[model samples]
Target: MTPVSNGRPVTPASPGSLRRMAVTLPLVLALSACGGHVKGVMQPLDLAAEPRGNAVVDMLVATSRQPSDNPATLFSGERSALPSITDVAVSIPSGKVRAAGTVQWPKKLPPNPETDFAVVRVQPLATAQQGRDWVHRHASGGHAMVFIHGFNNTYEDSVFRFAQIVHDSGADVTPILFTWPSRAKVFDYNYDKESTNYSRTALEMTLKALVEDKNIKDITILAHSMGTWLAMESIRQMAIRDGSLPKKIENVILASPDIDVDVFSRQWSELGDRKPNFTIFVSQDDRALALSRYISGDVQRLGQINPAEEPYRTKLENAGITVVDLTKVKSTDRLNHGKFAESPQIVQLIGQRLVTGQTLTDSDIGVGDGITAIVAGTVNTVGKVAATTVATPVDLLSGNIRPLPKKKPADSGATFQSESAPLN
Candidate 1:
């Protein structure tokens, strides 16, 4: 049968493809579970009684999504002519009741503060000046972190996830969330892809404003799934517009990026010689990327590549990029596409090291030793050492690491033909 996307009929699947889909059907269902939860959970609720040790995350939200008529749902999944900025505070339950790397979604409205993550305050920032003022007030040591969420995410989904990340990671930098219009439907993949394209300029403007701000000494960008594509495109656009990116834009982390491998190579080349410290989190077991690959005419997705393999390893190393292979690090996410934020050790590495402009290496000691220690601990618990390799420009120029081996012939049969292959 032919598959339809955005109401248009597409290519029909072969019998082998049908078998593959049947095998990955469970993963698709697991991925869709989040969509089954209560919508409009963004409605702020007053806590009847203050819970001890509750952590509050204050974030500046900039979105290109149209504002919802209902106050509870601030933004709807539709494109807006202009961007909007708002300040929101989400209250996370105490450490005793909640685990790290998890968002306690409310089961119903007027959520329980002792258990569910509830909204504490929401304030609109009328102008860019107000946003600058907010940054001035919140930025710690002049450090700011911008988070761009992935596909099939609502405004509330982005907000809560960022809050959980900030609180769980204990990152001291000011948090900013840049959310685009995502219909939050499992089947609206085309719409979501186009939405990213529509909002790239807005994101570029946001990044430009932050880079120009004197108050923000350093900026770190963390983007997940399809958002990584948006992030790369925005930065690439910035480079094209202005000869180079400002030095203040320090690091960029792409988690489970959904960009085509060939496209990402082009994006990286366009960034010029001077660019942010680039780090990517990859998983060969990423079922989500598998599905994405199938939908994108069998093109390989950057996030699902086997970094240890031939061309990727040499390509990544030559580009001076750090790679963290999380194929072995188990997480609650059945799709295995969110290990960057869902794994406690990995998230801590982001806050303690990466965001601080510190490069992660197995040999590093002193202030950055936490990365090694955490990796060690994770190895003991997960029974697999998360492979982390650094190929920084400095390391390559200094000849600190050994030479890479010769490339082998590409595996012709490794595409998504296996019935055991995961979903995207």
Candidate 2:
């Protein structure tokens, strides 16, 4: 039986990373849980009881060792910093699966890398070189999509999810994932924030390293939820460091990013629009961001934008950024926000369009075959062009094609339609 922590339920999870609670239930369900190996803080939970739920116990009893819970060790000398995590599992999901990665933190961190910020485990999707290598082996001549996950996810889930896209779309290129510190624990708000804070420099360093390396060509960073802040801040810091984004940095795709739009605007002004082709995947049905909204005092949520309330999209679009508003789509249990990445069809859509350097219009990802179709048409308000009409190009990823309708032939705001579009 599981014990209760301060009246909240607590249960020992199956041996797995605490990230992606929805995907991996019972793992994060320990009593009085305040556990996470985030970058900044080094806190651990004191679980009183063992397995509280039947499913959790069953999973634990049934599942094999997925290199479970063997996180980056902490430093004995440095209480403030994290240890190195070098655990690199390079196996793709042998089947349809979802996963993520982390900058491996050492179990016992030292003063230097620890204080300077230590990463216990990082994804094999390491430097752009690694990304390029993967691309060389995979498809070629396509834009690279680097997916950075947000708060409270395990390294495995994030990796697997992105892999699903890469595997599905068969986009020929390396898919790099920047793994930060995610404690995978609930209610450890401050710790998670600290993780984000500490990871900023590391992310920039990663980008800078890639900029110097020539193997990786066109690249893009796909950030989700709070991961958006990290991506945004990384770009901002890069400018502050080198006075501009590195030449290699091609585009950025912010999918339901957890960020203040106004703050983002300020950062955008600093970075300028020309550096990285920026595309924002915003949705109105984002329940997760809604929770963030309530916690943040009814601010303009980045993810939850309805078609009627497309002000942020209008603003960003006018500013020459591509904004694909998924408000017309439906919201799932977590929120419509995460569905952009969680759902299979959506992942397929991302793999097909964005990864292929396809431009999008309202029609492509607007309806039918899942949310990703909205990406088929080119929608960015390029070069201070005040929201003019750009016909949906017949070939979003190529030279020239027939002109298609800018708007949808038949708008299906909420209607779900099955499609057999190639997993491009």
Candidate 3:
């Protein structure tokens, strides 16, 4: 069957993808158009992360001689209480986490103790003022950047991932990671939802501490996967509570968000003219999200939201948000679920755009064969699915684009693939 790029499944392709089809997939993709319910599901039992790997070594090299603090908690892991904040010397001078456990996954990534120092877990306070006090005491300045991971992640995953972010960004920003109860064990989807709902109040409270307080100069949020929903909800409510989305809050980067696109725009409209410089990172080839499509009855997800309609596209741009398509710029991981954080190309773009606070262009960052293809397919897609590359946007940081000159294809991050999709 010749597939049209409308996101709806066309007649199944006959034994040929490109050579025999004589079909221009790009034309179909041209019409693609595309969230607001955000979320996460429990990961499988073996989803435990591997040792932090040589991540610590890289961090050491990337360090610019800085001192940090204990991370602030956005949501409590404990049902009745939040994680306690203490001076654990999150510094990785020793290069170890809890003296190493007996078990380990060869490919699994380890946690970054250094992140614990940067995004210090804020001690939850009985009042928002108390939380603000705690933040003020530990911050290097009047701003903070918080990270929240989607489903299938553990508290350990959140910390290490966040640490790498702090180290590489070269920004002296305070980091706070909010970890909801993830069961960490896959397959517990319902439980994960429960945890998400349960943590909403605490998440709101944390945001309140930042938004309600005038002392905070900057507030940034980086949420991946299911965490995007929570982040948006928090921001949406903040807008409702006040007349705007808070001027102190600068950027809100939603990477591979697991959200419903229609819902996103609706909620986004409620913010009125108060745009918060938002960014949406999407990849048509994300396998884990493909799995998400199946589990979600083929619903269009964050990574799959396509910009087909010019009205919505203009709406998004006018609202101060950029949708970066990243179905290309290969990386080292599978499933492509972690591309926004793991892929060097996308990472560089983010480090440039958000960290450095610079402007960018399409050719500056490359993706999807100079264009994007969004197809609905067997996936209950809200828009079309065109493969995209995250590298299309220029990094506001290094100010370098046009694919760094490299000799080795392996070094070029060409190994990235979708790990979650099944042939069946």
Better of 1 and 2 by lDDT: 1
What TM-scores do the predictions have? 0.82, 0.59, 0.59
How many clashing pairs in candidate 1? 6
Top candidate by lDDT: 1
Which candidate ranks first by TM-score, i.e. highest? 1
- Candidate 3 lDDT at 345 equals 51
Candidate 1, run of 10 with poorest lDDT: 415-424
**Superior candidate under TM-score, 1 versus 3:** 1
Give lDDT: candidate 1, residue 384. 18
Q: Report the backbone clash tally of model 3.
A: 59
Each candidate: what lDDT? 0.78, 0.49, 0.50
Off by over 4 Å in 1: 1-17, 23-27, 47-49, 363-424
lDDT of 2 by residue, 318-391 (tens): 34456666655554323455656545555565667665556656665545643532222132435334123222
Question: What is candidate 3's TM-score against the reference?
Answer: 0.59
lDDT of 1 at 41: 72
Candidate scoring better on lDDT of 1 and 3: 1
